[model samples]
Target: MSSLPAPTRRSLLGGAGALGVAGALGGAVAAPAHAGPWTPARFKGAKLLAAPDRHLVGRFSYGLTPALAAQVRRRGGARRWFEWQLAPGRIPDPAVGSLRTWWSGLDRGAQELWSRQTSEIEYGWAVMEDYQRYVLLRRTRGQHQVLEVMTEFWENHLHVPVNGDAQFTHRVPYGDLVRRHALGTYEDLLRETITHPAMLVYLNQAVSTKRRPNENLARELLELHTVGRGRFTEDDVKSSARILTGWSVDLWRTWRASYQPEQHWTGPVRVMGFHDANAAADGRELTHRYLRYLARHPATAQRIARKLACKFVRDDPPQSLVDHLAGVYLAHDTAIKPVLRALVAHRAFRASAGLKVKDPGEDAVSTYRALRVAIARPPEGERGEQYAANAILWQTAALGTTPFEWPRADGQPVDSASWSSPSRMIASFELHYTMSGGWWPTAGTGYRRPGQWLPRRRIRFDVLVDHLCQQLLGRRSTATLLKACSEAVGVGRREVITREHDLVRWSMPRLLTTLLDSPYHLRK
Candidate 1:
């Protein structure tokens, strides 16, 4: 079958940039001087998003949903809300509780998961696809948004893609492990992630033996996971490889993971300041010590601080904020929560609101959240359309990135420009329009009806526009937005809109699309 036609590059750019609206919206749009008393009196003090709250919620969560915005207010403010989110265990998460049961493949043991693929009962790619859907649903609906955001961050940082041929069976388990340590200390997280079977197999450490130690895992441990580059030498890498020789998995067979002491290379090893004597056949203790040293290294602290700042603060984070966070990381013994608290409390993070562009996964999930789309569980067999849990995975892929499917070990890029390309923006525009219209993935999902958007039976078009802006974008409406919305529906700003109006009957999608297509919705 022929595919849907894509927009021409010129048309896409023109569609967004032609309206001095999005370009002007990209910068702060001064709230309409005379537009006021718009919010319903009941929700004014409770749900109104102040500038600071919007920035905090937008920066941390996938996107600010109405429920989340209210929660931030009920909990006091952004700082208090963030503090509440820090301890994820205290947060009740019923959304993903049954995900493993829905996608039964996720609960299978490594042996069974591997056997199913080898016996052709199920494809490895299909199993991984379920994992992606599971993640998308969780991001869209989970109450513990901070945990989800940080899990994605560390999963990318110490990535073992579900597509890895040797690591597919262990991939889901690796993701679970990452989530467990996502809010914990970096030392514990690094140790657990590096020693996991998925990491070993993905980096070729499963095959590394006393006779021939592979340097792939070791080099990446320094360059990507821990100290980053320039702090360690070739000799450090070789020694690091030798130190991590015993952790192995039964590859291409049972998929069982075990520590084989005999396969370990026995020799004195030194990497940076970490040193161990050549004595024991079991090097697990030595490996743990080395990873702890690396995790606590000043360079590792700097690298982790800068990466966190860049992802949450801005594309190019300030050095002062990075330095402050690095000090917090060390002072707290690499605890993640303290570093996060320090980062958010810093002036740089507060000032960097609405500056970072959402990556593909963020964009898709946030759109779902903003639209208040309800995704139902898929049936036991095939999934698509009504099976929105599965269909949403492809939605993200069409946006140009699929979760954990980043080809290289470096994982997906987090910077703004990486996702700000014309093609990506056009793809996002198509997604906004399609979802706004409730066109695809119709089954097992519920899009808010046009009539439900009415605050009351009769309201002014501009007031309604302001309500959408506040509800969806976490801010009040700007004059440009009012004009765009009016133009989008071919109505006057002062015109009264009712359920019987044409704008509510058939042109609602166009109006919603105008807001979703704005830079206010695109940038966090």
Candidate 2:
């Protein structure tokens, strides 16, 4: 990517403000009237996805597709479809299964991964970049959309960025650990992730010992991961750090992780209400007990529930909803599935259509899905656009940040305002237009022809716009969308469109970009 001139606020606002995106995108898109999951859009004269179905699929999955919508309907509405998705083992995800073969470095062990960098065979950052591409590909093509969605949520919650020094060696394995327990109990997930070599090394726990207990991981485990801020004192942080001393990795050499009894700090420890004797050097059992206690703590439950609600329902979720989810979390012993069930059943979640803004990664992946872009395996060792996987990472970087690249341990912000800036919106607009026109990333990519967008040989422009609205937004065209499309393609609403018409020949991307730039696609 080349450097461009700095974006002025006036130009960005002018470019997107005309369509009411600058303000409307910061909140929910104007929602349609409330309808049952199986209700038809009688007013629009099209069998569009009911409001409930749209809200559920949009919130849980990357983006809605005609195929996905059909699957939701086939499973007897979104509620039933969600129930089936809870057990991902029954779902066959062949597309994402093959992606690992494309990026074999993802399967590399810690020792070899580090050795490759030491010997200049590959750079750590390059390997991490491959991991980013792998995740983006999964989000774009994976059939187990719910699993992918939760995997991202949990990964961000217990974040270990891929660019950490020697910890990058274990980053891939850390991600695998999170996915395995994505829908499992938080007690198990928190215990396992906090002990993983990636987390230890990233937060300096790998070097922590009885003589010197590193407080980085311990502080984050308390502040960001568990009870959150203002819940614990500095002395509690010290005790937490001492309790976490035994888990270590042979960093920068063999890169193997083990629980060394000699490295464990021995003393009394207390965090909040939980207390431990810490009499033995083998502190593994004590660590487990402590983590389980924290996972079941009221503050921790409230924090986890609020984060889930913020990510799935809305940024500032209602206190009542938060309290309800926390109760569910405790009632199920920290199991995530039951809590997710309660969340989707909540009225606020059902009514929160288009309330959340898509971050850069979500924006890119959803656009790829919306455009129905097909990706092929690239030739081995290819570079740039010659490799679709690599190109996709660059595409995300162009939008803003790549996946898991947040520098802080708290992970990326989950609020809509963080991702709703004019500059980000402008970048998204450019990406939509670029992908729509198939102007870049030509290799190993199959872009739909302009004619394929037309359902029939001849159709009125207004009807064509409605068809596109159905395809892109999963709803019928609105008066606002129709007017935008007309102005975008320089055609009257009632004008007849054909394959040879200028609108279809060279200007179709403009119309698609307009829809993509709309809040209907930008949010949720």
User: In model 1, how large is the Cα lDDT of residue 24?
Assistant: 24
Q: Give the runs in model 2 whose Cα sits over 4 Å from its true position.
A: 1-18, 31-46
**lDDT (Cα, tens digit) per residue for candidate 1, span 300-407:** 999999999889988788899999999999999999999999988899988887678889999899999888998887887654435778888898999898999999
Cα shift from native, residue 259, model 2 (Å): 0.9
TM-score of each: 0.93, 0.94
Q: Which stretches of candidate 1 lie over 4 Å from their true place?
A: 1-46, 383-386
- What is candidate 1's TM-score against the reference? 0.93
lDDT of each: 0.83, 0.85
Location of the lowest summed lDDT over 10 successive residues in candidate 1: 37-46
Cα deviation at 354, candidate 1, in Å, is 1.2
Q: List model 2 lDDT by residue over 302-376, tens digit each.
A: 999999999998888999999999999999999999999999999999878778999999999999999999998
Whose lDDT is greatest here? 2
What is residue 378's positional error in candidate 1, in angstroms?
Answer: 1.0
